[model samples]
Target: AQRHSGAAMAEQGRQRMADDRCNAGGTAEHARPGDPLRQHREEEVGRERGLHGALRLRRRVALLGHLGLQHVLRPPAAPLLGQGPAGARAEVPPHAGRAAGNYPMATMVYFQCVFAAITLILLAGSLLGRMNIRAWMIFVPLWLTFSYTIGAFSLWGGGFLFQWGVMDYSGGYVIHLSSGIAGFTAAYWVGPRSTKDRERFPPNNVLLMLAGAGILWMGWAGFNGGDPYAANLDSSIAVLNTNICAATSLLVWTSLDVIFFKKPSVIGAVQGMITGLVCITPGAGLVQGWAAIVMGILSGSIPWFTMMVVHKRSKLLQRVDDTLGVFHTHAVAGFLGGVTTGLFAEPTLCSMFVPVTNSRGAFYGGSGGMQLLKQVVGALFIVGWNVVVTSIICLV
Candidate 1:
């Protein structure tokens, strides 16, 4: 009877151990102290709280008094007739642009200025999240006046660079490269997003991102077509080529996502589209549609790879923390586009346009070495100037 009792106790002990093991293998696996799903839920809650805080902060900021007292309590203006330019003394006729006036022409010019301002605003991606909204409001006009104006004057305004034969057919150097450098510099000044914000929630408004993508697609009509300052065959070709390239890029990026993650994500498609747009900008009018197709493929693949691979391996990327990967998108993609332009420009196509050209870049026959060197020189100058000026502007 004693032996049987001892055996029974041992059996009970074994059964308890087996039961504990089974419990450990079941939901206990998910009950770890720091499961990723639990952490993700916590992150979502934190993000909601942060957004609520930011909204309240912005509301309070809006209530702060403006400089209305100075304007409202000031001395009255002198008579308009004696104050200044012809408008000060003369009443303009309402029907000024009836075939003998500056009304409609001036309106067109104003619209162009608006386009320029909007483009720079899009470049402000690097400043988001950490930038003081008030400071950005100030920085906008300042950057436009100081940086963008000079670039426009130099490249498109028939300034010294244009006369020196720097061909930016579109805006590889002016828009993408310049903005990339400036964005990086501005980020350095503004610092990074909150650590928790950075790691926890990348973009709270992915839907807004999709809307921005649609705007971007339509906006190329103005971005590239307007460069010709006319509606013409070349403009049509440019617009078509732009879309084709973007579509191809989007498809390629999506395919990449499927290969790796078993899903095709819209965000990846948008990234691919953006890269296609940036790459085609330099050669929009000059390259053939077929060439654009090839360029788009390369742009999508190379930048995607760079962002996923080189950035991961590089100390510089880690240090800069370029919030939206603007460096890879604009700077790297734009630079490559410029180089590709040197390789694919056809003299036949170049001659059809009014823009002066020595020869189609290297691949099209004449002075390949010279064309390659010119492209490099132009891209480097823009990059260097923007980096220096942006740093100074931020400091000031």
Candidate 2:
């Protein structure tokens, strides 16, 4: 019992150290896995102190397309931002920002690849059994090269949108929104599954689906938490918000199912869980816990309305073969999250995680109104880009 007590005390010490590092904002001296400041400054000043730097550098340098020259700048290439002339590596000094080290160069490419693959998988969900394997095989490289890379660059990778101060804390636009829209677009191209199949596409295994959903819910912690690039208070809050929003969404969805259909549904609960996660992701660490609850409640009902009522009412929506309703779940919920983020993002929290100075949600009533506009415009840009790029890929 004494030994266990000592261990617990040690853990508390570590946590307090981490919190210190997080608040003071020092270099990533111990960032082996990119631990944010959690103690006194270490000797080596880490590259990309927080998410701002992480977004501008880590994912930017990492999300190289298969065949795009502009995205990937290899070693001898000139530094992107430095105290030197615009061109030529020899002209730039080594001590300039981002020129000192190849942080996140090869080591971080896998992270971008994983996200890109996730977007692809979500796109596939809408066409699930109907898409041709050969076509899908051909489609993956093209879409990744064209669609995914562009969005990553434009948003998180420090393109025009990032400069415009559009906040997508964890790929609300880049991954979820893009995939949802692309999935719907691709489904349109592929046409609906067989009438008989569409009419009765029962799950082959509910138990397996439940297990998969559970695994996904667990992983979502990393998905939102890792974005802060540290395990500091913001990261902790993000993880907590993820779980809170998901649980609230699941309950709300289940309650709605019971009220409308007179029974609880496992499927509805899963959908609720997903929407909740997607909804909070944009501002998971940026908003307060109370805001997370509000977002979850909206996520639960809005997507439900879109999927249950709107889908049923809209003939055009009916024409599209969105098998798993990825459009409603991801696209709608992602958009909701983005808008809510512009509305609820707290100033202090935003300062910790968001790179932009004086960034706050509309609820704070400063530049938040304009921030909301940016969110809407950002959504429109994503929607338009995916619709065009995915369609071109499908046709080709």
Candidate 3:
């Protein structure tokens, strides 16, 4: 009786094992059709694919900001007025032509947007750590429409200055000069940061600041290069000149810091870099390599003196609290660039890049002296316009 019971128990155990195997095999075979886990995984995969597609679409839209849609959409023509001698229309080269479309109209819209955006960013420098959010929200749109547009039209859009033959290579007047003056004006109205914050303000992250500076430096390739409205030889030369000036400026500034402050501050280096970049922008392509180095050295030293030495001594500068010293970096550097461009702009390069026919620097003789006067006049107009407009905007 005991043996028979044991055999029955063993048979029952085998049957249970067989049932477990069958269930496992059945689940594997039917997983895709009915399993909840498998269905959830498929749904997850679909969501991921959709997310990737959306990211790709967003990337393409961002790229359009750099490559003007008008250029991509329409055929090219003389993109700006006064392209050649005596207002003669210059034919666009194929490569440069390929990048620009719809001539003055579409390209104008795109460039105006670019310049407007940059101006807003520069203006923000003065308002940092202070300024009411609501006021800024209102200020930007109004400033863009009223102030920036006026400058853009007057300078580049065949308005008074365009016809008058005022040359602004990549917005020395429209962007830097305007922003610097406007920023300083606005800061006066907005009031200064709290006393404690002003006295002890320190950068939150040096590494992050450096990273941002690096991006700014690299992006300049497009900043000055795109002003030509095409990918051309002038664009290439502008990019090279931009780097040359920036590097020279950085070295000069670092050297000054080491001599005076006894330490080479990274922040100081970045400031020097910016001043150098701003200094060369007015004639990035219209100046030779040697001219770029000269501009850089002056940009680095002059701004340093104004910011470090003059700022400390001047009561007005001390009282105003021009944060980041936009006045020194943008205003002073920009004006200096304009003056030097007048003095050093290579005649051959000027003819190629500037729309003003027979344009030459002061060094080249002829109407070169007149050109320098025009640069100063252009800067004055910008300064006056910005001061008035910015003050009104802030006051209101």
Candidate 4:
């Protein structure tokens, strides 16, 4: 029994010693602070800091990228208190002054580019059926920069002319007038189509022309509706007024064709419809539906007469040989529209849509002071710019 008791005490002592050794090793490692859990925690902390640093760096880079892009893409800001070279104020309007970097303005700018594109396409009609594709590629961008951009910037981009209060309404002076004049000018430079083509002048495919007409008719909804920058009642009014003018012009033109030629030609009717659309563009948002009808009758008849009778008689005009009849379609129609707007502008409607307090046009109980002056200035500015720029582009 005594031996057994002694052996048991020895065994207990050995077990306690082994436990002490293990405890000592644990204590030593913790005291040195080299435990795996502690190292893992440190590593985790380091990884978190590195991730945070990376995120901050990325944010800074993004900010710099945005600033650089803004500088490149946005128009330079003009001084607010200075007078421009020609006595125009160097101030941005309220619409243009709002965050210039906003997406809405960018979208509007892109829309304007589309408008410029379509105008060029219309001009291309004169050069069609014969123009080399390579020449057209060069002409499109050149004319856009030289002719379209200046007119757009000057009239709509808050440049010198707009500050002086020239109301183009929806581009009677800026788009149609400039495109017409520049198209005719370029056609003069490019010269007329082949004499054989001139003699056999019917379109190869009237169906295509009719299709283009349909697209144009539907697209005018966007054309005029987009001018107001919103899908509001004014857009509706403009659309309604546009259709009225087109319908009235069509009927008038058809009647004239039957009376003059003893047959109503679809081609002649198409010309009248186009003139009506172009002539009413400037006045669509401001004039009543009835006024549009009156404007249309005059536009259809006068421009048709000018193209059919007056152009054939004039030696100076024959020398130019404006292939697509741009003079009558864009210039004459646009000018007539501008003049008609000055004559038929309804006071209430103009006051509502135009953000100004000028009197109605000469016929609508408004003073002629700002009206006639504004129209004349707008037209002259567009015409003068086109003459200079079209000359430069063609010559260069």
Candidate 5:
């Protein structure tokens, strides 16, 4: 009886030791192929070590790239105050006001490059799903040099429109209008996507698209806020107006969708958001908050009408096959913004934001009417130039 008892105790001890080993090895007898607890612990360890290391590496690489770009650009020093030829408060030198080793100039250059990049991305909307990669590579440089540079110079670089007091606070005409017209023209030349794509070019991932759109929306704060070239009251107003207009336009658009289509669409709301942002851009700092809401309403409704109603009716619009409706969202909204800027730009705000002295909207009752005329003329010039240049580029 004592020997049997001792044998039982030995067997029990062996079984407990085996169980301990299995647990420590993370391969318990009952463990499945993918043990949840073990897998989770492993993932946590990886995140702590691997993710932190990767993030550090990414930040270092970005910093190195930025330094290289700064070195290559060799931006000039900031202009000195009262250093003009005649001793008047000198115009800020194009590369003026370096806070640290020409950082100001580098920053300005970076901003301009980003603006140009955005323009290219907008133009790409037309060429998506088609266009030879080689041609696109060549086309970018040519378009920037000839088409984009000319617009930038003419409007913002003290060219004809700048001298004439036509205000584009943040590239309503230069970026949005230029890209829209250019995209439409390019689409005509490149031809449509395959019929299958056209018949059903559904977004592969709606959530991802929404995420992209959210980034774009938030980025507009920098887009408009930085135009003042300083962090001032105007910049603050511009950023606020941007959000207000975008939100209002989104709500208006969604409501319209629910009424007409019997359901709200995330895509439609995004489109409305874009239109509102575009519409307010030209006068972001130059218009009052109330004007922004009014502009939002117009932007949301007019673009919606054009995209949904006029697009179907107009043969030219139908033939172009602009995949993303850049024409309606950008061209129409931008034109509307320019016109409204001419009409609603407050005198005080204009004085603060516009380069031209005493600039005021038509509603302010001075040379305001002329401003409107100039705005229209400027739009026509951009449209004609983009159409001609884009066509030439495609043909070449």
Candidate 6:
């Protein structure tokens, strides 16, 4: 009887694993119903990742409130809850409901939904205070359908870029670059905020903004770390690289502010932190700690120059009220990250993952040049697609 029961349990474990309902604690051997210790450990691992996601969601709330008080109060259902979630499924595995990687099918579905939600929220910041809520409500689904889905598929969902070996470790391109470009483009057609309002878009709540910024800084553990979809070495390195880049970027950005602006601005620090996070994301797990710091230094200074220097001179940028400077932070930082990944991605690290090819960074020379070219082409594809598609969506 005990033998039969053990066999049954093993069968159950195989079934669970086959469905991708994997636990963090162990493998098939730990699937016994009586293994409370392993089960507890599994729960702990899951709780950690879940909290990371929850923390991000909380931080996002703070950002929305800071970036757009009106949008914060408005409902997020603008995209039709049902519509977006369904599309997320398609983005992952169109042919099957099986688990895609280390996590469960349900978990994959959930995260995809969250990614979509966050992307929409990030894009909306550009149009805040100027566009009507009703128009936003209508715009969400249209943009998701026309702009986001295609981008997601082309990058993460095993489209040409994925096959061509463009590494995005996370959504530096698919989410940030695409949304930033789309947001800026849409903001163009939507028109700028009133001159008086544009001249002074004061924060509604500074304390909450700081609180949100702190949470956002912390939440990046999951933001970049969670891309590996595992609690292994890759995710650990990703978390480490993420923090290293962010801290370096923050300090650099703050120093630039002090040197040029005559004061260290809290907003400037937060912007720097975000750019660092975005900048390291594309190669978080694939690069060394030192590379992350190099990336951070560049991420901090480059975006600041563009937002502070270039924005003032660019007639097109000034004409379009990118209310939150999405172009500078997300689009520019994200594209920089992708290209940097091609320049820094380690071949040995890339060897661990079956999906990643062209792992050698340009810094290593040889085929690395090809990888960098691929990254540029991939980023350009996303930028072009968003600009064209977003304009069409906004026009309609």
* Candidate 1: clashing pairs of residues: none
lDDT of candidate 6 over 1-396, digit per residue (tens) = 999997886566546543433444456554664455544443444454354455446546766776775454565453554656555633333222112366678998898888888889889889988888888998899888888898888878888888788888879998899889999999999998888999887878888989999999898898877776765567777899999999999999999999998999988999999999999988898899999999999999999999999999999988999999999999999999999998988887666542655468899887889889989999999999999988887887
TM-score per prediction, in order, is: 0.69, 0.74, 0.73, 0.71, 0.74, 0.74
What does candidate 5's lDDT look like per residue over 1-396, in tens digits? 999997886566546544654765744455553455544443444454454455445445656566675433344354666344433433332222212233467788999899899998998997788988999999999999999999988988889888888889999999999999999999999998878988998768889989988999999999998887865567777899999989889989989999999999999999999999999999898898998999999998999999999999999988888988899999889999999999889888787756777788898888899888988999999999999999999998
| lDDT for each residue of candidate 1 in 240-353, tens digit (9 for 90 to 100) | 878887888888878888997899888888999988898888878778888889889888888888887898898867666577778788878888888888777766555544
lDDT of 5: 0.84
| Candidate 3 structure, TM-score to reference | 0.73
Per-residue CA lDDT of candidate 3, range 237-259, in tens? 78999999999999999999999
Please list the Cα RMSD from the true structure of every candidate, rounded to 1 decimal place.
27.7, 19.4, 16.2, 18.1, 17.4, 19.9
lDDT for 338 (candidate 2)? 94
Global lDDT of each candidate: 0.71, 0.83, 0.81, 0.74, 0.84, 0.83
Compute the lDDT of residue 149 as modeled in candidate 3. 86
Can you write out model 4's per-residue Cα lDDT over 1-396, one digit (the tens) per residue?
Answer: 999997886566545534544554643234333345433343443354444455445445656666675434344576687545323432323132112233476797788878887788767765666667887788788888868888887777787766665566678777788888887787778777778978788666888888888888888877876676755456667788888898788888888999999999888778888888899988887788889999999988998898989999998678776777888888889988888887778776666555446657777554755676677778888888888888777778
Kindly give the stretch of ten consecutive residues in candidate 3 with the minimal lDDT sum: 89-98
lDDT of 2 by residue, 99-196 (tens): 22344656467767788889999988888889889999999999998888999888888899888888888889999999999999999998988899
Worst 10 residues of 5 by lDDT: 93-102
Report residue 101 deviation for candidate 1 (angstroms). 17
Off by over 4 Å in 4: 1-106
The alpha-carbon deviation from the true structure for residue 122 of candidate 1, after best TM-score superposition, in angstroms, is 3.0
lDDT over C-alpha atoms for residue 353 of model 3: 58
Q: Which residue pairs clash within candidate 5? A: 78-96, 78-97, 79-96
| Candidate 6 Cα misplacement greater than 4 A, ranges | 1-102, 354-358
